[model samples]
Target: MPRGPPAIEKPQLEAKKGKKEEPKKQVKKHVKKQVQPEIKPEAAHGESNKDRRKQVQKQTDELFASLDKEFPVNQMGPEPKQGPKTPATPTLMSSSSRPMIRNPPPFNAVVAGTAASNTAPTACRSAPSPPFPQPAPIAPAPAPAAAGQRDDEKRWDEQRWDDKRWDDQRWDDKRWDDKRWDDKRWDNRRWNDQTWKRSRVQDWRWKEEFERKQKEMDEVLAKALAREDAAAKMAQQERLAAEAHACMSQQAAMREEVAAQRAQQERLAAEAHACVSKQAAVQAARCLAWTQQCATVSREHEQQQQQQSDAPKMQQQSKSAPKSAGNWKHKNKPQPKNCHTNPGQNMRDGRRFKEIMQKNESLKAACKEAEGRAAEAEAKNKELQERVAKTAELMKKECKSGKDTLEKLMKQHEECKKELKERIQKLEARKKDLKERISALEAQNAKMKEALTNEQKEAEEQKAVKEKVHRNEDEQKKAAKRQKTEGPAKK
Candidate 1:
């Protein structure tokens, strides 16, 4: 018999001499009432095992209440406490004598009903015989002095007890088989529980690891992005610097070229000025020489005019009966000494006149030559003066052009300076912006590094938690395996 709560006995149908018909009706009515209420609508509708268990519990509770009321157990007092004594009842009608349905009826009885019916008869046959009846109520004892008969009797008694024990052992073996099946089911449930718990722990650990890895990857990507941005900004700045340097070099070269041009213009002007001064000096010297020569010619001409006047007067007096010639003839040749004296005197006078005329003609030719030279000199001087004025005007124009060019160059230089200043300011502003950006990037990078570190720490903690969970799961599995291996051996 299974070791558990005693069964509820159903009273045997025994006919009463006085009210057999009425008692049958009453018993049938009572059976119908009990059966109708026991088959609950909610229990029949239940789907899950838990719901079915609840239904079974409700039924068991009802049965237990009914049994407890029908056969209440008396209280026993504690030690040193006096309790009232009650009359002793016969043990013949105890829970052990109840008709027990050994194999519990299934909640869904339809499926198990046939099998239950088939096994019920067998179970009844295997049950112990009632205590009221005995096959041999009296047995004659063999004399103690007769050894052979006594030994025979004793052997027969022992054989009978052995057969009874064998029957009881067979019944006990069947009950043990049933209990072993239930134990196997309980063990399967426990193993499933352990597997579920371990799987849940593993799933949670995997989830944490996945999250940590994802976070780490995000941080790495962000750092890479920040680095790329910084590199690009630096490259841009380098390119700008190269451009600015190129511009400055170009400006310096242009300024050098402008300076060289201004110097060249100044040198040309200086050379032109020198040539004008040299020409002017030569013209002045020519004019002075021509004036002196003209003065000398005028003085000589006046002297010749005075001499001509005296010669004419002398000729007139000689023609008339020249006082000097007459007087000289008288004084030198006494009174008349021939006309030879007059002839000789006339010849000498003619020769002197011819010489004077030759001298005058020569002087006139020289004066005409001097006047022509003077006129030529004056023309050359005027031409020189005109050339000098033209040169001066050209120089003035050149100077004016140079001044304009210089002014233009100066304006350009100022403009270049202004542009350079603007460019410098722009570059400075850009540098400031880049510096601020770099600082911001640095701060952001630091924060990212810090966040990455924090994530690493968290990941490490998760790994530790996962390891601990794995260890616990391993231990639980080991214990479960040990229990499984030991269970049958213990049984």
Candidate 2:
């Protein structure tokens, strides 16, 4: 009769030649997780593998968004570029005995209804995935060899065991076909730290450039303001100088006019004094002749005394005349021309002095008029000086106000800068705290998943052991029954 399938044996791992083409185990446990991220969100409740994958993918997208936008990643196919460094891509193969599902199963069987769990996941059809390793099927324990068994029977049993081993080996090979890096779409791309460092350095350079531009703009604005202030000061100085020069020119013109008027008045006064002195001298001469004619008797009495005095004077003169030279002329010099020997000459001199005094009086009147004009000019000059002083004070006040405003603006700028710095620091601290909390939560979740997976493995192992024990006992009872029946028949 045709024999049945060989007795099943425990699944055993097979040894392979090389490691490159050999596939590895799968599931999140086998793959490495992303390293510490700069920014991380807190973990939330998730039911299935798809939810977890989506979460991790979102975080990865956020972290590399800048890079990805700047340099788009190639996501054309599942196969990587062909190079010596590139690893082989996984291929699906058909198999017998065990049915392979083209679609993925429901992630959470407990949450899904029984009917839903039996159905495949909808995502598998849209997206292709590599095969995954399944748990090894439970096998019955091997039957012990009979003591009286024939040589042919031993050979057949050995042949059956070999066939069973081969079948299990085939299953193992198909299950772990493409386990390593199969979960990631971009696994072929380079993940060297140098690439990441380059991107980070680029970002830093951009920030520095922005800061430099801002500083340059501030400097430009400051220079423009300074230039405007300097221009205003220069204009003010020019205007003040022009006003001062005009005032000085006006004062000089007024002084020259007063001096010219005074000179003209002095000239007229001198001419008038000369006319009065000549008229007085003529009147004195006329008066002197009249007086001499009236005083003849006095003149005769004076002549007798004069002759007595002249007798001694004439004798002295005659002696002095004989020794007279330039030295004798100097010793007996006649009375100086200014000496008032005649009464008429003295009278004319007094009259001339009086006329000169009267002319000085008239000149004093003209001087008074000039002084009045000077006072008026001085008053105008004082007004102009007051105006200049007022303008200067106004400029000073404006300058002080400008300085105060500048100082206030500076204070406000400093305050705002400090506030912004404080706010940025607080936000950074908050971000750090959130990141730390998220990392802790992720670690905790990983530990819990690991424990659950380990517990499942232990439970499955214990169940397999128990099943093997039960199968062995059943086979033992069957062998004993067969020996009892066959033993009687052989006799």
lDDT of 1: 0.43
Give candidates' CA RMSD values in order: 23.0, 27.8
Model 1 TM-score relative to the real fold? 0.32
Please, what are the lDDT tens digits per residue for candidate 2 over residues 291-387?
Answer: 5643653454355445555557766866776564655764675633343345576567557656655655655565565556555655655565565
| Alpha-carbon runs more than 4 Å astray in model 1 | 1-341, 468-491
Q: Model 1, 133: alpha-carbon shift in Å?
A: 49
Cα lDDT of all candidates, in order?
0.43, 0.43
